[model samples]
Target: MRRVLGLLVVVFVAIVCAGRDLYEVLGISRDASSPEIKKAFRKLSLKLHPDKNPGDDEAAKKFAEVASAYEVLSDTEKRKKYDMYGEDGLKEGGGGGHDPFDIFSQFFGGGRQQRQQEPSRGNDVVVPLRVSLADLYNGKNIPVSMRRKVVCQHCHGKGAAHADDIQTCHECGGHGVKIETRRVGPGFIQQFQTTCNKCGGKGKIITSTCPVCGGHKTNFGDVEFDVDVEKGMQDGQEVEFEHYADEFADRSAGHVRFRITTTPHELFSRDGDDLWMDMNISLKEALVGFKKNFVHMDGRIVEVNRNEITEPSQVITLKDEGMPKYQYASEKGKNYFTSRLLILCIGQLNIKINVQFPDTLSAEQKQGFRELFAM
Candidate 1:
């Protein structure tokens, strides 16, 4: 829990700030190069962009700051003005350059007619997770190993040796979309549009492909994830592991879904969230008082006692002894459980009435039986 809390704190600090300087916002020195500034802006803009963090006003504002920094630092004339007169100088040097999204889109692919970019997610991988009913009732964590596609570490999914090594498409001239004119009749032509074939519609090609992933920008690898089996988990229910599926270059990772499967128990049977078991009592024990110890799922021993006469196939229910409720509360203050127990009691005394009387009983035994019946 502390680890999760710490991660959230890190994310908060990374997204929000208290008026840090332009260089500090980009986390670069004042002497950083143009290429270095470009790299920094690309990374931060992708993370804090309004496109990625839609509806998050804080992140959107932060992205604007980042883009402003890159807008000044990336231009030679504006960088000189900023270095001399700071942000005020940049405003005097030129109108705020361009919109942050436009800058981002231009850096990725330079075109004014921009298509709406939807974050891409890979195909979801669903697998079965098997567990005992006791595990489900008590709740537990199980480690699961998966084989999936991850971004190439060597090139960081760029699929190139260097950012400068990427070349603009020869056919589309980096617009990604191409226009074609077809001759229909005399002096009449039809205009159509299509994607650039040379760069596969990306508007750029890597001069050097990554050695590890062979320009696919992804690598096949095995990863382990902890699957939490929450209390009162139902069979065939799905537990999702977000952003853990296949990853691609400049694309969002899909989710991994785990379907819960509860295994059958030999001694106990399950009915929804409740447990059921059978118990037998002797004739004397059923007639008088009796107590017995029952070993439970976690090896804890529980006492089962009865003083009244039991009937065959009779059910005894115990409340609050079942599975814990998943985010379900019984009252305002008390957290309740969804599961319980149903015990089937079989009485031995019921069988004696149908049996024939024993002829070999001794005089003492006969007298004892007579005394017992008299009582």
Candidate 2:
């Protein structure tokens, strides 16, 4: 009996050593990255899937091997064990018992039928964000803080203390719904289906609920995100954070959008990419000539001078002094285009002159003004 046991151990070691390399199975190198491994697995799985090649035992076996290889390599700890100790190391680390079909289904969005049964997205959340004109003019990253529903950290959204604590509901048989018959009239019956009361339409029962969320599988947590206000962004433009809304168990999180709303500025108003401001000037400055300076939105001092007479309500155009033109995704990051094309797209600043007149003129001042205007 001892000899036979020794021989069995030797045989097992030989089989494990002779087994094909997992990397070679997926057609990737030993140094392949996670994304590379995933890409290779996706390609091979698509071609060797049982649905694609039915009744081919060879393809089916290869598909299973590929799934197993990906399952190990995708996990950081499992992959480290496998790399050091091979199959025996994996066994020692409690690895390599996952269902291959489950991994495959999850990677490919649960096949076609399971995808249809998956829960829809939750409700989207939109919040209004107020920004100053200076922030929009110079581009800013504003940090926003809000409370949102996130998956419970304790149970990982399982709603149970342990995996074994969850079991299929007996009343609905895991269908999440039950059929009932009601008497409508004499010798007549109406049948209808309704959510299972035992499972609360979840099709599963938790023996012990999660302590953090109390079986709700989610909790409201404070989250902070940055809202990028690009230069020349229009009012009411939405900045979307995908999958950042309230999360619920078994459902995808909806998107969160922050709609940009510019606060009223005391000096400047914007239209498209252009900026307009009223410049108050004394009557002498408008009639004779003057040089004055005004502060721009970005704290730059803009100088305006008129050697000739300036009139009230006259608009002066300052080229390339307003907001910077927004660089779209398609046109961004090109050095030559930014230097040549975008440089010419800056918005103009229109300065509307408003002349202040004196309430009354003395007789000597009126005579001097009349004599000066007579010239």
Candidate 3:
């Protein structure tokens, strides 16, 4: 009663003063609206959310600051008062505010607790996918079929031909788990849940089973998926297919992750999304000139014309000819992955020169070579 009355009195008597520094903490203007404030809060929360930065006191403290700022800016009256009288006003209002941890939970994983028995996600299936440098350069999708555990199509995961034959287990009372209390010591006890012995952890049992899948809800079957090989994707990078690996009755399917491995390409050698190759040039061609169209990984013709004297280790760099940038860039923070494409960075292929000489020179060619050396 005193907390509420005291707050009302303080709010009524609150006059003008300076401002609280919450805006600075959130990196927003003093006049920021609710959406701008929320955006700032979300950005900080994603960075400092406890799950992402577990056991770190510094991140926890930073997250608290973000939550505090959101608390003040979120409420219009509190914001007005804070803007007018700063921290002193909050003190005068008797300090009724949110718990930072509570706000953080609500922002991240709080609502999940209110949901009905959540389905368990199956284990992630990791496989190595071999690819060529050309696939990475051109960006192609390779179709692959993997035999995985998936829900039975005939039973639709019910494990029974007739839905009416499925009945709830009387032992666990439709709950798959069985809880039992254990005596620890004098006046001490422990409780735990285990798989119900009657239904075998399945809340329901089928009297008449499906002919195709037998009684089990899941069966190993060939699941086909396409791997979209992106340009510039690093070797051993994971390409994930959500909920496509393993399946269980009433449980969410686990993800299928492909760790990309590159096979030795015949033409180009890759290095962290960049490519390099050697172009052999004959003595006559290096000295005089040459013009030809080189086929790129995507089958596009790259025109190359060399007219000047070529050095043994001279390199020809073609901008945007390396590997395509991976898709990860397009997703993270709004406009965080901007590439000054014109700047000679990744995606530029370097073709080096390896000059060749004949084993033996003809008399006329030797005389001409001698003349050229003399000049």
Q: Which sections of candidate 2 miss by over 4 Å?
A: 1-119, 179-195, 329-344
Full ranking by lDDT: 2, 3, 1
> Per-residue lDDT of 207-320 in model 3, one digit per residue for the tens?
898887897878899877767676667788766666677888778877788888989988788866568988888878888877757788888889878888888889988887
**Which segments of candidate 3 are over 4 A away from where they belong?**
1-119, 153-156, 160-208, 220-222, 327-335, 338-346
From the highest TM-score down, the ranking of the candidates is: 2, 1, 3
Better of 1 and 3 by lDDT: 3
Q: Specify the poorest-scoring 10-residue window by lDDT in model 3.
A: 330-339
Clashing pairs in 1: 322-339, 322-340, 323-339
| Cα error, candidate 2, residue 248 (Å) | 1.9
lDDT of 3: 0.71
Can you tell me which runs of candidate 1 are displaced by over 4 Å? 1-119, 283-289, 328-375
Q: What's the CA RMSD for each of the models?
A: 15.6, 16.8, 14.9
